[model samples]
Target: MENRSDEFSQKLLNEMNALYSLLLLFFYLITQIIAIYVNFCLVVMVFRTIKDEYKYPYYPLLFLIMFSNVLFVAMTTAIAVLGGLSRIVPALAKSFPVLIMIAISYPTVICVLDFLLCIHRFSVMFWDSEFWSIHVRWKGPLIFLITLPFVVLISSISITYSSLLVGVEIDAFGVGNLPLYCFISDIALKSLLGFLTFVGYVLILLRVAQQNRKVGKFTDFTVIEQAFPIACFQLISSILTVFMHMGVHRSAWSFAKVCLLKYAFTQLLCIVVPISIIIGNQNRRKKFRYFCVCLKPNQVEPANHRVCITMSNNRTSTTETSF
Candidate 1:
């Protein structure tokens, strides 16, 4: 009786494993394709459709963030392809440790971009000086310099953490060799980022709310208001994903499923987040819609001539003013 029970348990586990392998493959492939399309469209729009006078102060950051997404998606797409193929050619499993290593740094880049934007907005509001304004043209080089140390540090930590992990070559999912740990470095990075971005988002929201409530509010936080949707999405999603991951923190089928869920949420959020940033600004959306329809509007509206777009429980209004 004991021997029969052990055989049955083993068979059940095997059957379930087979089922999940197929599900994971489909999930990875489908999400990667959708991400590629959405990010590609965003890249084109940012470069081609943007009006010169649309002086979105965070334009450089926004562009860099979207472009970073493009690179991240491209890397993930490659991971999905190679992971899918590794099943047939078992030797390919060796490279997953390296690939996942490279892929993990992508999110750190997003965090850096968000932090820079948030800090810049905060500086503008609090300092109210020509500090950031004076070096607007040098924002690119300035960001690169500021973030280089962080990127380097994160990469080193991730590599060290990956070495500590004992990856499974053919886990229940039967894809590439999977990390046995719950992506410890990734969780740490997200946790740190969650804290920083939370502070930044709260400050931005509080300041924007105060400004909006003013009588004839002349100097509203236009940049923060415009970046709010995307920033909010980033914060919410990061918190949720970290919570979800904590629940399934082990090397098992549940762990694989949890990771898959994270990736799915990622694909959805990446597509929505950039669009949210664009939609936050009314004039930009107008030109975006026009460009999508393949019609170039002869007169492109500028951001200085503001068109306010606000939503309160399904209500929206557009109040024009000098931004």
Candidate 2:
């Protein structure tokens, strides 16, 4: 009986492993596809539509965000692909400094950019004239430019230090990792930031609620609502990251497995902003309607979406407005 049980358990485990492997490979391919198609479309559309944001106070921040999303997809896909080839080709793996820089530096910049993005929304939503108008002139863009290098600098040091602690094991990480301790720390830093940003969003939402009660003040939820999608995801991702990392490491998941999980969630992160922004912009959404005739040209985005993009918890669009 004992021997039979052991055999059954082994067989089950093997079957599960095989399934996981197939799924992971599928995910990797999807990541590449998303990187090329989605990011490419986003890049072109954003630059083409650059002039549209001229009057919008939060436009520069969106530009930074769109640029980061483009970088996020492209850089992550490159890292995932090259990181795999590197493992097979030891010479390429030795290119750690460059790989490490791109891997850690970029997303860390993104996390900061996201937080700044949150901060930007908060300012505009709450302080339309006092803080926002002032910031909009030169302060917002200037601050983003000034702070970017420092964020990257901090990220490089963290990656380098962590690598020193656990050796440069840069194996296919789109948004996440090293040895157990090192990996935990990496996730911890991002999650902590995500948490803070999430809290910031909630606060902004509460403030918006308050503002709704008041009159005479010009308060639209446009910027705040646009940001809510990311803010919500950041909080969710932070928790998910910690959970997924623990599971992957304890099971001794392969580099590809790790990358797949990261890629899946991170790709969603890359997608949400562009989708939300585009949907909010009447012109861009019109452009989408033009391209995707499957969608009703008269079909409207989610209501309250000039300020928020809400959908059913389990909704899949046959149209472009799904996001």
Candidate 3:
């Protein structure tokens, strides 16, 4: 009797675990799909609206950030969905080199971009130089071009090092159990960049305070407001990554929980910039809405109205009008 009871309990537990994994996968797929859509919309919106202005640097910087995010999120979503499907068919477990490339490259690009954004915000707001006011149009793209070589070099080194992670098993949900040493090395680099970005933002804030005191009103805070959420996420996500790393060496159950939390934060990172832009800036929000509209204005407009004007010669002209 006791043997039968034990078998029953084990079977029940196995079923529950299966159910949990299924639910977790559903959550991941849905959230990541939404994130991909949002990030892509932001990319299109920026591309359509980019133009010459003193604050123009922010647009290209933002465009690159969202463009990278759209690609990364789409790749991750595919991997995650396949990760779940692989359980039912072992053939789906095939790993690809692009997975390794993305794992090593995406964070490097994002962290660097985040820091550049902070620097842009700092320079534009804190400095009164002619270069920032007049030449930022070309300077933004120049800096991005210069930074590319270093990012590629660093990512190549990391990928080579990652290849040395023998028997690094990726879970059914596509999360890798990276060794603490590997995780820390990557996190340390990101943390250093994040720290510098935080410092830049702090200096900009102090400068804003000083200017506000003199002018007796808030001045040039829009960009700062837009950047604040991203900076906070960088700090919070780093701390979460540390905790997630700690769980990687533990039990599989614990690691599964960590992966769910990691996905939540990852998707949240993809969504943050879009939400920030939509809420913090009016023009970008309008542009984003414009991009999201499905029907053409002429198709969606109400029935056209006709108007007639009579010229001095008693000639009548008719025009169709639409709003």
**Top model number, lDDT:** 3
Output the lDDT of residue 216, model 2: 45
Tens-digit lDDT track of model 2 for 78-111: 6656767755544433442354456555545566
Candidate order by decreasing TM-score: 1, 3, 2
lDDT of 1 by residue, 1-323 (tens): 44543443344345347767678668756766766766666666676556763365666776677777777777766765675676744433444344445545555666667767777677776676454544543574476568657674555354443332213232223223323223455566666765676687678677666786775465655456545655566667677866865575334445445545555656665666556555555555655653442223343345666765554333456667674
Number of residue pairs clashing in candidate 3, backbone atoms closer than 3 angstroms, sequence gap of 3 or more or interchain: 0
Residue 69 shift from truth in candidate 3, angstroms:
1.6
How many residue pairs of model 2 clash at the backbone?
0
Residue 225 CA displacement from its true place in model 1, Å:
4.8
Tens-digit lDDT track for model 3 on 183-218? 545667777887787778888889889888898877
How many pairs of residues collide in each model?
A: 0, 0, 0
Model 1 vs. true fold: TM: 0.65
Ranking by lDDT: 3, 2, 1
Candidate 2, residue 186: how far the Cα is off, in Å:
4.7
Q: What's model 3's lDDT at 277?
A: 58
Compare candidates 1 and 3 on lDDT and give the better one: 3
Question: Stretches of candidate 3 above 4 Å error?
Answer: 1-20, 52-55, 77-88, 95-104, 128-183, 250-263, 288-323
